[model samples]
Target: MAGTSTFMEVVKAAAKQGSAACDSVAIRADQKSYSYQQLVSSAVNISRFLSSEDLNSSAGNGHLNGACVGIIAKPSAEFVAGILGTWLSGGVAVPLALSYPEAELLHVLKDSDVSIILSTEDYHELMQNVAAKSSAKCSLIPSVPVGRTEAEKAPLENFHSSHERGEEDPALIVYTSGTTGKPKGAVHTHKSISAQVRTLTDAWEYTSSDHIHVHGLFNALLAPLYAGSTVEFMTKFSVRGIWQRWCESYHEGIKADDAITVFTGVPTMYTRLIQGYEAMGTDLQAASASAARNLRLMMCGSSALPYPVMQRWEAITGHRLLERYGMTEFVMAISNPLKGERRGGTVGKPFPGVEVKILEDESGNDAPGVGELCIRSPSLFKEYWKLPEVTRESFIEGGFFKTGDAVRVDEDGYYLIMGRTSADIMKVGGYKLSALEIEAILLEANKDYGEVVCAIIVPEEEAKRKCAEELKPAITLDELCTWAKDKLAPYKLPTRLFLWDSLPRNAMGKDEVVIKAKILGSKLKQNFDIPSEQEASNP
Candidate 1:
């Protein structure tokens, strides 16, 4: 229902807006726009195309009959239509990342049992080979079609309505990969997808003029479109390109007609933007800061936003970064209030219809009141695609899904994410520390990376250059502890430190999701300890 557009009745409306239409749903980096009418036309055409491929005669006597349709395309109107078309045809849309390698692509295609791959022309060859290997048919997604004339729109609605999927029917299978595990596809029904967009729309109060950029389908693109907002696509992320767009929005204090009003990013993007801002001359910097300040909303997620970065961005832009906690399974759960206090270092309380529990009782932890965060929400995924056992184990007795991340509530009731239970949590003596909290202070690499309260730190390039110029160790353990002791607890400080050139990241043929800690931890040389006398006292 969310994706459905008023067909023939809206033809005159779309034609009035011209090529830059979606009533301005999406604008590509190159400045091409697709109207809502065009999207509906393309979706209808795609649905018809798929139905002709023997999908209409499937079991359930429905189009596709719940087959998986893998979609490979860059963020564009075509991508949106691909999803809408799959839903219209009663197929589950599996959006495959172009960044995934051949083997990884094959794995996903096979895992989801994708019956067809609707890839864009650019990826047709790649997807075709992969589809062949996976025993799946491959077809290039039709380009976003032109909207029909006023008379034509009336007939198109019924043409697509015949293949309408039920609310309870499977609509999407989003595959989420962690730093150190095989990808797991989370199945989402049409109802769940609708709920995700509605919750985001309600919480964020997305308006048509609130131009936003973020990640994930529902958060970055779908929810905004659902709220009648214009979604912009950047061909590739560029620190300079983003700042210029914000400047264009509010240049020298004049807000452009299509000024970007909302922005979202990870900590790294903000860090780079800060660095880019600092590099600017006083004149340009002032203009950039002023333009950034004009934005109605700014957000950060996908990971924790560091306090230092958050503080500096606020100093420059005058916008407090709204930090949130979410997962691929549910999109967004807890968030700092839109009009209330957005506390730093914590993701705020749950949404209106969301239920969250801190399951400290199950963890048997040394850190009191810290445990896995469990959530039950309307936007919650239906199940893991095909992994019934894993799906069942992921929930608790009360239908609350166990989020493996450890969380604790502050006195003000704000939720502070400690770290992931399997990866980010480290046990030292009688104390358990969050690696994310430590990483926020000190940074890491190589086989010498320690197993205990050890750190493999890669010094910043400037710091490395400065140390190399002086012909000394980049940073000594004494120097680090002396600097870090004021910030971290005694036992929480890294006892063993390895100064490395770089950390082993997506090296050794592993994907980007491979946990560097697991790789580093496995190859750990030894653990070192400091004397009790040298311990940094915690207040």
Candidate 2:
């Protein structure tokens, strides 16, 4: 944490070794392959631009020199280059999600006090406006040319190593998905970033020969790149495309040169993939299953994985989904093992250097052994940016970060997340119940309910017709209790139910449970002939 820069170490190593040693394709996207040399070349170019005399003068300082650089680009070579360039120029990278609205983008930009915004041309107009709103300078990220000659490449001469940063310097500021409230920036340092990437690389057995398929660019992209693995990026997640790609990779019983060995995604993606598989014709389903099973690893995270989804996926693909627990504060801490039995409904033991403990609830009212899951790891973020008091409160006396997740350990010492301490744990009749556990049980019990759960409004006339066509009445409180009678304790059953269209989800595919509950609760009150406006006050 004192002397070195983690990302720069990889860059410098690649640079010193030249093409052959680091020459494997580091990124494949949009039907193009980019070598590690090309990626480093592009990053050096961007670094030079950032350190130019004119730009420095305009920015009101000599150089970025450990300042924040807001990056707004889709998952591509440009995004990776931008991050590397920021690090090369002694700046921290703050990746602003493209999925964020203008207001949310501005909020993050202003909150981090970003010195500059580097975005692709596609979002130039929008990013310009966002930059204006946040008072941050804007620049276009030059397209990374493929197979370019040395003479044509941007030189790193103008870039000064005098601004090089230490491991303790801030390297990234990723905002939490604001499902609860306003998003908070979690600041990660170079040391923490290195620890995370190294842990994942060692745990997953990543290597230069492996190819990882990634959707969004967080741990999925960065970790593999750090391990010198080739990363294939998808512009967006498509169940059909994913299956088809896998099928293509292993066509004619031979593995293609660009075969993807590892894949990671959220639980909802798997659920959708299962739905896609089920809808496929017999022959196509067989091909998809065979292709998917050949992949070395499949992982699921971001939200609790439903048992049914995991079971069905394994039944089809033969690979049990390795479920893991992580948060924005720490990229990853606990994960189901790559070699050992990956048990369903439990995130396995801590990573090699990570320490975990279950802090018993002070109320002493929870079910035995249930408490807040706490973690102390080298990979833990430095702080919640600009919120010193909040950051201090988040950790206990021994530097264990309170994860705000309720968890209980299984007999084998694997951790089973009960739910979020605030939102996912519901108190009913003096007993705390995990909404996720209930959701999982409901998903299995109601086979005819299909893939989705939760409520949404529809036309009153059409709603009745649809209910009749489905051959089931709108799921009612009595119906839910009757079905959950044997599966759940009486207190754990849903007291109220409104069968509607769909659930609201955030960008990361996590269900917005708190917001949905409030909306559905309000609608239920309205249906009961109570005033809608009074519902909020009553709750």
For model 2, state the Cα shift of residue 385 in Å.
Answer: 1.3
lDDT of each: 0.70, 0.75
Clashing pairs in 1: 8-153, 21-24, 21-35, 22-34, 22-35, 22-36, 179-513, 179-515, 444-456
- Tens digits of lDDT, candidate 1, 98-160: 778898898899999988899999999988888879878999898874444563344443563
Q: Which stretches of candidate 1 lie over 4 Å from their true place?
A: 1-22, 27-29, 60-62, 145-156, 361-368, 441-474, 501-515, 518-523, 526-539
Candidate 2 lDDT by residue in tens digits, 143-205: 888775663343434345555578888999999877645689999988888888878888998
Please report the TM-score between candidate 2 and the true structure: 0.90
Clash count of each predicted structure:
9, 0
As for candidate 2, its clashing pairs are: none
Once superposed on the true structure, which residue ranges of model 2 sit more than 4 Å away at CA? 1-5, 15-21, 53-62, 151-160, 216-218, 448-451, 455-476, 526-539
